[model samples]
Target: MKRSRELQEELDSDSETAGTQPTIRPVFKVTQLDSAIDDELDSFAMRCNLPPHREALAFKTYDEYEVHYNKSHTNRCLECRKNFPSEHLLNVHIEECHDPLVTVKREKGEHTYSCFVEGCERKCMTHQKRRMHLIDKHMYPKNFFFAVTRDGIDGLSAPRESPRG
Candidate 1:
């Protein structure tokens, strides 16, 4: 763990160039003892009959427990170091938050589609812009179901040459 932290610091410092955010995904190590304790604790939570581990390390502080829990039990986002309780939520987080970083690389260098709302003339060039237009201008919720494309809103016209955001 110490070695990994040192390596992460080195990577972060190297990547801290002007106008760029450090995007290194920090690695995590899950010890066998932690894995066993997590499994046993889940079983205990479900009211399953199980004996406590004789050698499980007792956490001393909230921070200790949180760190161990995040490392051993949670679906963690390495890029941002946020932990999700379930795999579905982790995937959703990746889709909504981190996936845009990849999609931005695929932009065609132009605005491809107009806003989905009726009577709205805003043209959006990327996934985040399209999403923001709906959320900010039309009061759409962050998790709104409008696909980032014209076909998603209305299929009345021919498809654009640009890809779906």
Candidate 2:
């Protein structure tokens, strides 16, 4: 009878603690008008569960760049150093691993896409802009080669065009 009473008291104490605990809820807000391509990118990011800001999207060759333009830029996982197609996939990884050692912080900025064409100082603000520059300016093929590896090295391939970046 005494053990039963003790167990009951412990349960009651747990209930009280749970009742007193505060719940944390994620806050979401939409602000201001953005470009349609930007909106599409945002939608894609959300769908993939990736952070909004990415550091770099470098390709060895303009051909590789052409291939990756339509797809999500791959990023290296800080914890495992493995490459993922998108930040969304990385976030999913964190969740799946339930890694206490891993931490993710969202900084304010859009994903950066760079032109790997040698001496062509073309750094696009968005992937879509880069695609436009490649197709319209450089006449890259509408269909291009997509690299499967995310080695994160920028200077893997030679530039097709003269220095225009």
Candidate 3:
């Protein structure tokens, strides 16, 4: 029994020492061909996502100088000199070329009204223009007239009133 116990303790210590040895594995491995194959797969996947109409359409690149010939010669346009990768470029072009910076003088009896909202004094010439201004600038709530009441007017009483006799 004492011999068996001594043999068992010796075997356990040998196994623990063997487990502590570091493992050897492959490292720093990738080739140019592997990277090329990855890039090709990514481009192929992107091409597959496009619609049939878009895929059929030919890719066209136009000369910017030829596109803006009139503006290039006469005016000092920054947009012509450089490319702006945004939807705002057209708006900037129109404001710079067609529209004058100073306010235009209006003739007598021009159709204009002060904005109905308090603190806003902008004059709008048409109902559509006023509605647009309210929507874009003030961010006024839709159904505001029904949902809100003017300072002097009672909401319940105004709805119940008959036409003036």
Report each candidate's C-alpha RMSD, comma-separated, in the order given.
25.7, 22.2, 22.6
**How many clashes would you count in candidate 1?**
0
Measured by lDDT, the strongest candidate is 1
Measured with C-alpha atoms, the lDDT of residue 57 in candidate 2 is 52
Query: Who is ahead in lDDT, 2 or 3?
Result: 2
Candidate 3: global Cα-lDDT? 0.40
Error of 3 at 56 (Å): 78
| Distance from true location, Cα of 131 in model 1, Å | 0.3
Worst 10 residues of 3 by lDDT: 146-155
- Which lDDT tens digits does candidate 3 get at residues 45-132? 2222122123422222224433433222332234333222122323333332334431231234344434445556676665467666
Error of 2 at 77 (Å): 13
- Enumerate residue pairs that collide in model 1: none
Candidate 3 TM-score over all chains jointly: 0.23
Runs in model 1 lying further than 4 Å from the true structure = 1-108, 148-165
lDDT of each: 0.53, 0.47, 0.40
Which of 1 and 2 is ahead in lDDT?
1
Q: Which has the better TM-score: candidate 1, or candidate 3?
A: 1
Better of 1 and 3 by lDDT: 1
